[model samples]
Target chain A: MLERIRIVLIGTSHPGNIGGVARAMHNMGLADLALVAPRCEVITQDSISRASGADHLLHSTQVFATIEEAVADCTLAVGASARSRTLPWPMLTPRELADRLPSECQAPSARVALVFGREDSGLTNAELQRCHAHVHIPTNADFSSLNLAAAVQVLAYECRMAWLSQTDNQQPASDPGDTVRPVTVLEADDELASHAALERYFEHLERVLVAIEFHDPDKPRQLMARLRRLYLRARPEQMEMNILRGILSATEKAAQRKHHHE
Target chain B: MLERIRIVLIGTSHPGNIGGVARAMHNMGLADLALVAPRCEVITQDSISRASGADHLLHSTQVFATIEEAVADCTLAVGASARSRTLPWPMLTPRELADRLPSECQAPSARVALVFGREDSGLTNAELQRCHAHVHIPTNADFSSLNLAAAVQVLAYECRMAWLSQTDNQQPASDPGDTVRPVTVLEADDELASHAALERYFEHLERVLVAIEFHDPDKPRQLMARLRRLYLRARPEQMEMNILRGILSATEKAAQRKHHHE
Candidate 1:
């Protein structure tokens, strides 16, 4: 899973940041490092020195002319952006992105790229649009300027956590059949709804609400945003989501009948 | 909450890593950095250069002679360790630790110190014992060696996430009275059991287990460790823990009565 993850840096301005990123990747056992048209000297002393003992990553680091070329082989490309754009793309927190990766990278030779943009400006709209999804590392809203390497470290850490969880799932059950059970169990057994399924549900929900005149699509203020926050927090199961969609469908049919009668 | 988090680095070997750590802390809005008996010079060019724009954090960084001195006033001190010790202390993943912090730091003047050990060898057994709990950043099992600064960045990110969640919770609910409700919701209403309360419960639990002869205290293999993991993961509420303790007390009384009958 770690091998399937490629860390792509776009137009990095500082040699130190390049080195810092190498160190961060090495720290989390991620070795595939790709740079997209970096402005700094990648092999400078500052980079090597900052990389600590991870200078070897710099030796084999691949440099690309563009983000597309760098992540050409990746099935899922996630762009890390801190700023909000006019058109919101599908967004995931670093942890959520990590959770979604294992299944995506299950097939042999499947690849995923975590693309990071320049330190100051970040990814351009066109660059961001090219990616499948955007990842936001939740930081202090007031002072949300994260150092490039630090951002990599946070994402890399989440990737490692996801990999560990996947490995734990694969491990054979070791507990004896008859043992003193714990007083309190941790996790519940419900499977969480997938991102794609949830997105489809949201679209269906919005259309139904508009048909019923519950929400005006033209004057939609914070309704969708608030609903997104609520559902994202809830992380409903597939069955629960199906139940919700059923309710929405019934409501839409009832509203249509009332409209015809009027 | 971020201000309450004090990042303590103990016996740091490299000046550059200290600077790197300072940079990471500042990036995540953690202003309190404390160094305990660092081996290298703190104000060196390497430290300043590595700090980048976070030199202010370095300038006002607190220096202490011992871990005890550094975290004496802190209510919660979490030690960061990659290696498992012979006696497994209370362990939390970075995320779990983050989830537990906001409430703990809600009190005015409440302080929480995140302690990191030296580069080559981590915290001494004595130093780890002093901490209330240990936080382990999930990394590649095969290559679990993380650079100190990278480790700081990961924890700081988690801390920031926790702070953000807390802030989001405090925001005014802007949704109209009537709307399409979300199918799934995430968090429960139970306030997690505090560390101090949990520790007291553990002591009582061990005594009861010994009285009932359910667990042999003489050669306790991983009983306590396993129990700690279960409870920590469960994060029982105050009422839940009280119920558990009541059950343990009842079991102990029954065991005593059976012993008398025999």
Candidate 2:
């Protein structure tokens, strides 16, 4: 999956940034690198020295005349932009981009390209529109400026994580199925409810509560917002969501029966 | 919150890498950078050029003779390592480390230090043990080598994210009330159970389980371990923990009654 992903830099101004990006890519096991008419010398001494031991990437890097030519073969092209544009495009956080990469590159011939722009000014409006999606690495709004290579390193790291997760899912651990494992710290299970499902659940909950006269819908205070915060904080798993919904349904039925009796 | 994070690079051999780290730290809004017994000159032209525009960090950077002196005032010290060790220690991913920093740095006098090791060899065993926790940046297992500055950038980015999340919570969007707002993305609420409280709960849990005869005290095979993973993954809030403990106490009482009946 990493091999199928190409890192494309457009009009990079500094050789050191190019070298730094190469080192960052190699650190995360990404080898495919494409430069689109860089302003600085790609084979300069500073680049080689900055690459540390990853000069091999510099040696084999492909330089292209245009962004379209550079990413012509890629099925999915993602442009990384730091500043917001007047026109809104499909934007994703770095993690979201990584999560979708496996399916995006599932085809044998499918390729993905992560395009970065110049240091001073990011991808032009036309260049950003050329890509299928845009990735924004959230930073301090006050100091939102991130170095080009540092941005590449972050996205590269995310890609590695996404690839590793896919591999782990495909291959189970070596230990026997029934072994009593020792206390190993584990990450949170990936079975939590999706944003869409949670949204539907919230709607159902709000409707049921309003019907039962728990809170007047027209004059709703912070009840719904507070509930949203609590559940979002919990990050409920599928089973937990089902249980909560079940409780809400039962309460709605009981409330309807009481209203009918009254 | 970022101001409290001190980045300490110990025994760095290359001046350029040191400059790169300073650049990375400043890019992510971290200003407190300390060098512990560096092998090369910090104010050289190589470092200045590598720093890009973060030369202020280079100029004001503090120097220390030993790791102990560097982090003496820090309440929490986290060491970054790419390799696993024989001695098991508390470990956190970069994201997890970031999530905890907001609360950890809330105190007026509290400080946190993120320590990096030499370029060739990472932190010594003694240094690793000295840290309150260890942070492992997940990399491709095949090629786990990361540039020193790149690692700093990743952690610094996470720190910035954490700080941003904290600030956003404190000051919400513009609106007094009565606005049909879109579903705003929010982080988990800051009411999570503290590490100390969780530790105490675990001790109480193990004792209660043993008293109930559900597991043998002499050979408690993975019960506690599995429970730890489950609870840790859940990351229960304070109220949730209280509810869990209440259930446990009720179960314990029921078991005692059964024993008395027998």
Candidate 3:
């Protein structure tokens, strides 16, 4: 759905804004960019400067004579509108537009175009009418004037957010929440430290703690218990447990070496 | 709450980015802007144009000499990171940050800051350490060069949306479970370890690890990085941090005592 999403700028006055929009789109994983009769030159040094490193998007931008021609192949077209005008249109928030995209682009050929208008005067009534819905990026009422590129960033961001959520939802088995090692993000075969392994680690740790004089075997004083609680809460993976054991063994060796030297 | 949300740009080389960030913040009803050693002039012609009409934010922006100074008053500081770091820090999505804001700012004096680093290098290790958590804006992996203003726009937009949801709907807190991988469990804002405290803990840990010869300073095989990730994943409370620090001190004492005996 993200790749299917296209950013269309209509009558954009600033060529730099076009470059800005391209960078915004590329950042959010959207590739397709369409320009409909831009008032200013499409590709300029200013635009490239604003585009930063996303000049590939600027280079491959598709030019169209009209909005109709621009979104002709799109199954769904959502115009970025500041506010509703002469006719009331089915308005959606950027989030709502993102939510509707997956289903909207269910078919293989289905394409979605998110259209933006002139910097000063927004989409003309005809252009607004052509869109299936007008998606509004809720901005501060007092200063709702979002820069052309910024608007693209907001919508593209939401689109990417929704896509990420969808991607996460697909992997129920490997869901981070459900996973045993909640934090590590270890890519492969990261089993949790087994109860037996944990017990052995605790024994090794206790011996080292006593050798270091951190824990007194004569008066254990719930030290091991407290340590157990802390380590248990951490839910260390097998690899992490090995690291802990390595440290303990190193501590023991140091203590033994010093004792022998003495 | 949005006004309380400050956008801190660290070493922002481009003055126009400062203006662009100001405009983005203003669009999303955010006001506070802090600059930490900006490389270029704060207010240039390019900045004024990029900021559009939100120059008031630019004009009223606060300048800070350091990250600590910039975020001194903020109770919750979330740094915007691009990808997975070597030492895995607590990561949050924009939505996660917005969702947690209410609880985060329950205290009257609580201020939340969204920190953006230098345009090219992003946040340094030291800068990242100053943040309690890192918020990563999901971008296209291949071309993830999000312009500074656009990055601010995405985060600010999410903040606004979260505010809207909170205002419109009574219950926006829908059990913030394991949506993010690194955050094991985030308790109430008060008990969580402050960035300064976490920094101290890390310093103590490195010292002890070095003393034990578990970590080598010269050919560091990411030993400290791995340890940092493990501890950060645990999200130790203030009390736990104290306990851990005490253990480090004890270990250091034992190591020193053994060396003396030898």
Candidate 4:
């Protein structure tokens, strides 16, 4: 499960924070790392010093052009948010995310991405919309600004915790009094849709809305964002996603036929 | 409960790590910060930068000469250790320590101190003896060395999680399905004895042991450490400590009378 966990950082300014994030990820046994349009140089003397023994991770870290490119293959992309947004989306605490990871990773192709944003501004509205969910680390209200690496450390630690719990459950229940949490094993068809699939669905949905004259692309308000939130919150299964895309395709075909008839 | 949780660092090598610790503590709503003979300067540019907005905690940080002095007033002092010891004292995962904190803090006079040792060597046996128990953060076995600030951050995050859980339990159980956990509130007489008082009892016990010829202080192998581990594990209540003190005083008096007879 830990092997399938990917850490994605977007617009990180500090080289040292990148190093710290790598070290934090390695400390918790997470390996895959992706940087989306990093503002600062990825590896440097300061980063090496901060990384200590984990500079190998920095050397091997994959850089991407955008968040979409970074997490497109991931089944679940959860963005780390430090503030409340104008648009309320589904939110989970670090522990809650951890608790859900083991079950989410049951599918062999299911990869989970824990996305972190820039040091100062966090994920933009557009960037956050790409993720399936948001995880917030509980902090003192007066001082909630966690360093980028520190945020990764918290989430990575939770991922490791969730993995440990799953491993513990795999062991035979030694103590009768212990209440073992059942891990949800996904059937082949029940696997969640990947970020790329979801993104395609959103695009298709938007085109159909425009074709039906229900949404004005030029004057779009929060219609698209709200729809994205609803669908993302639902975390459509592979079969469910297929159903949704089929319905969308049918709508598009009908719209084209209606135009031809006119 | 968080107010009662003091973070004590013993011989910290880096000023920046201390600053990071202060920030982690403040972020978790823990206020008390104590440094026991730190190797580097406590306040510096590096520390301030790492601390960000939590430098106020650094300015108000308390410095002590010894681990005993730093945690003397604390009812429960838990040391943060990375490696397993040859002589195993009681060990807890960070989560377990956090889970136990709320009930431990129910006593009005009870103050819980979290002792972290040197950045390189961790808590020494003598220093570990001074704490009631040790907390080891679970890490990747292949690469278990957590950065000093990262270690503090993990524990502090757990502390915050525990505090949040307690706070949630306090709220009215509005959901019909909510299984509310009962919070254990301690009675006044059941208040645990302070570290200062425990140190005095240990001093008295040593004197009596030497007088009765049960212990040879000159050649004491692991006698004192074992005894310290035993008593610390017991965590004697105020009344229980008084009874033990009375017994020790009586033994001393009896030994003095025998010496006069000789």
State which candidate has the highest DockQ.
Answer: 3
* Tens digits of lDDT, candidate 2, A1-262: 8889999999999998898898889888799999999999998887887687788999999999999999999999999988548788887778678889889978989899999999888899999999998888876445566778889999998887677667443323542221112222432334677898899899988886665555577887666776676567556667556655654565455455455555
Model 1 error, position B41 (Å)? 3.0
lDDT of each: 0.74, 0.75, 0.79, 0.79
Question: Which candidate, 2 or 3, would have the higher DockQ against the true structure?
Answer: 3
DockQ of 2: 0.12
Worst 10 residues of 4 chain B by lDDT: B171-180
- Could you tell me the interface RMSD of model 4? 32.8
Deviation in angstroms for B125 in model 2? 1.2
Residue B151: error of model 4 in Å? 1.0
Residue B4 deviation, candidate 2, in Å?
A: 2.2
Question: Looking at model 3 chain A, which ten-residue stretch has the lowest summed lDDT?
Answer: A177-186
Candidate 2 C-alpha error for residue A254, in Å: 71
Tens digits of per-residue lDDT for model 3, B1-262:
6767889999999888888998999998899999999999988998998899999988899998998788876767889888645555667777777777766655566678899999999999767756767777777766776899999998998787766655433222331111222222345334655555666788888887888888888977766665655665565656677777777776787778677876
lDDT of 2 by residue, B1-262 (tens): 8899999999999988888888788777889999999999999998897787788888999999988788876757789977546444457778778767876777656678999999889899767755666788876544566889899989997786676565343223321112121222224344555544556677777766665554466885545554453454455556666655654564455445455554
Task: Give Cα distance to truth, residue B259, candidate 1, Å.
Answer: 38
Q: Give residue B78's lDDT in candidate 2 (0 to 100).
A: 84
